[model samples]
Target: MLDAMLPVILLLILLYVGYTLVYKTDEPKKERKIHEDTQEVKEKHVEKPKKHVAKRKNPVETTAPKKQIQAEHPLLVHVLKGHTSAITACAFSPNGRFIATASTDRTVRLTLRESLKSKNPTFKTINLPYDYATACSFSSDGKTLGVVTADGCKVSLYSKFKTKPECITTFPVEHNVLSLLLNDIGEEWMTTLTIGKDDNTEIKCWNTSGHLLQTVNVNQIQNYHGVQSLDNRFIAVAAYTPEVKIFEIQRAKDGSFSKLNKAMGLQGHTSGVTDIAFDGSDFKPVNHIVTSSKDGSIRVWDINVRYKLQEDPKCIKQFQAPSGYYSTVDITPDGKWIAMTQGSALYFLKVATMQICCEIQNAQDDDITRIQFDATGIEIFVQGTTSRIIKVYHLPIE
Candidate 1:
């Protein structure tokens, strides 16, 4: 019986050891299965989210074509490259077929219209040397070009050189030419290149035939400089003796000049006169005179009454420059943009709202000397110091 009890205890110990070993092995299997189930559930949830994802369309790959800009609001299309030196002056021929640019390079170029598609559309250059060109214009027929010299104080007339330009005639003037104009038919006018110590202001008129038509003398004014004539009947003159003056100059058969019997004079600029532009189309939006001064301001006035000092020339608008002394200023023919040079920078202001448009920052540093719009108001040409080339800008039509 003792032996039987010992065997039973030994059996009980073996059973207990077996139960412990089995429980430990099964516990590991159970935990592994639960972990696997949890992993599967997590994977299923992640896969569900992926199946419900929304696709996105790329903006660069849009299906519809973009709308084009309108004609009245035409966009800028950069075209021809311009001058290499200080561009003294620029103008578009009345026909808009070519652009004339005058520079301290002592040359003027006739830039042809090339398709903007071309990567390079440079001007077919024509060489004309004046002492230094300050003012320039194309004859109405676009056949001749006139440029004033800074040193020689003369007017050089250039005719087309095989559809390019060639200097055909030159006339000597005792004074430097400050301003000039040639009408649709080559009718021309010129004013002081040098304000004389004589105190007699001189503005001369000529015809396409190269005949002197009138000589205007204004002893009362210090330096009479700009002459702009319309329809060959009405003449506008801007002068300075530290003051802005406008006088009506009349031409007679004897080739004599006289201030309008009853004239209008304007005085507002605090410094010497820099520029004046006449916009016949904007006769009402602006006065006949828009003058820029070293004082860094522009004053627009209606000197239509200047012959009569008692009659006030309407001070329509005044725009100030952003920085630098006002070197030069011009208004688009339609009276849209007023561009002025301040030191080495170019500042453009919208006439309608007097808004500053842009300060053209070239990767290459150059002083922006002069700015002018094309005849059709489509482009701007600029030049200045350290300038090796002229920049032509395609502009907005609106």
Candidate 2:
């Protein structure tokens, strides 16, 4: 009986040992691994949710929309880069469909104003007779363009319809031509010449046939620029002095240009006047003359009251210019604002209040030689001094 009892007890002990090793120890190890894995998964889920929530609460949502909006509305709309030398002058067609540019490379280039950024932009370049093309202007009828060389002797007129602009005509002058002007009907033109040692310069008006119509003598006018009013009844000249000379353009009863009469002088600028601009088309004369001066001031004058001022020409509004010489000034087609350039910067001023609306700092790589507004005044073209590039800027909507 003792021996049987001993065998049974031994078997029972072995079974217990086997049960503990196979079931209890292995089960606990498996459950521990599952628990550890579940805890790791839970921790991962918690961290992931926190990261997502933090991202949603932080700049991720705000900055994304802002970046998208900024991408959609770029300040710089287009860049034109065909010129091989420094650009001297730029003028937009009256219809606002094209822009003509003159360069020291002895080239006049026409670019479609609307398609400047297209894959194959439409541009026509004509080689000029002389280098250092100084200035250019478009006739208000959009049918012809006039370009001048630095010597002020050769003036080339081009017809827009021709492919090569077969040398429309050349007008000879005695002095270097500094500025050129064309009438709205494309019938008449005017040019300003460089001053000589005798402190004398000539402002000549010519008909379409290149016949000189009227010649007015101006004394000591330096860096002179001229523009005709929208009605073509007045021509305003600004130079390296505070006084701007106003001339009345006389027209015949049959609507032909006759001659120029010295009207008066606008005196306000303390230093040399760098640029001048008219408000709108000559058909609807605004009688508003905007001017920029080296005195770092931009002044607007009402020509309607130009003759009333006894002493200094009174400005309707005045504002300080950006840093550097106020090299150029242009008014929008709508006559609501003025665009001025000093050095590489472009400044926009509200016409009514003379408040600075916007400023594009260092808008170009070099000096801004010219500035122009399109027909709608929604875009601006800026030409640089030596870069030979035209930068198009879109006016920001209020």
Candidate 3:
């Protein structure tokens, strides 16, 4: 009788528990208590309002890092390696503190510009991609960047940040923009005078707002490519061939561009033109134009005579590029010296005698492609074939 009673009691307890759970549910999910400050956003539950939550933002928000990898200019500074393709052009910032390089790698780089015999000032390197960037330049203010593309008919302006640059606008080009320039005032800009496949040599002038202001047509097709001057009074047209043709730029009352006169024409190089730069007009008496050619020669033109379209410049001087294939040529802003490249070797020539004043014996090497000076003309920067560091050279400012 006891054993039977024990079994009966266990069965009754199990049945009671099952009935309580299965048939006696207390409340629906709607009656469940919720947190007072909880909220939902994009499938995420927030226990506190956005104002109460700590906001996360970087004080120095970095932009998309350009695809190239390299440190800024180093103390031993081997700074830039260009794409495997030929690097086209390079420029220094207006303040003489930064360097910008353009290459066929479809990207450009901005780095601190430095110059020293054995110790280079440190600088940061950051790549900027413009897809097919053929060349890049900084305005006189160092605030805007102008990019020349290979296959495009426009010059792209990028607003430069401390770490990178942002594309501000694209100035539609009349021809393939072999080069782009900003005037001294930073108000006007000039594009390349290119010989189009259609047998036209046109230069499209524009303002910062992307408004087309004027178009000047020349007689034949040519590439006035390389360095351009921003003097509101003169336009330097570095010809596709080894010739330097200059024009007088007169801003008419209507704010249009018109050639006042063919101010100068220089012809001395046997090979194609490589690069050309002008010293400051404030240089002693007359300004000078320094040019480099593929034939490994650097020439200086005295822009003292205002020539007609077909005439020649009155005074000119020439120098031999270091014994190698010359790739680039540049001049300091104050018009004191010239810098040109032959492979990885860089040569600095004095403006007065055009003598080799200084040489970075190994700037780029046979693998090196381009070189340029800072706006203040104290340092030399280089671009190498697949080298992150082109090369940095600091010369004693004489």
* Segments in model 1 whose C-alpha atoms lie over 4 Å from true places: 1-88, 103-106, 114-124, 128-135, 149-154, 161-167, 183-201, 207-213, 217-242, 249-262, 281-288, 303-310, 320-325, 357-365, 394-398
CA displacement after TM-score superposition, residue 52 of candidate 1 (Å): 61
RMSD of each: 11.2, 10.7, 21.2
TM-scores of all candidate predictions against the true structure? 0.60, 0.74, 0.62
Q: What ranking of all candidate models by TM-score puts the best one first?
A: 2, 3, 1
Q: In model 3, where is the ten-residue run with the lowest total lDDT?
A: 190-199
Candidate 2 lDDT, 61-177, residue by residue in tens: 566554443232267888877888888888878777788888888888888766766887788887865456788887766777887777556777788544656567777656666
Clash totals for all candidate models: 16, 5, 16
Number of the candidate with higher lDDT, 1 or 3: 3
* Tens-digit per-residue lDDT, 259-359, candidate 1: 34325555667766756666543123324556776777786665555343487777788877655466566666666677666665555677767777755
> Order of all candidates by lDDT, from best down to worst?
2, 3, 1
State the C-alpha lDDT per candidate: 0.59, 0.74, 0.60
Give the higher-TM-score candidate: 1 or 3. Answer: 3
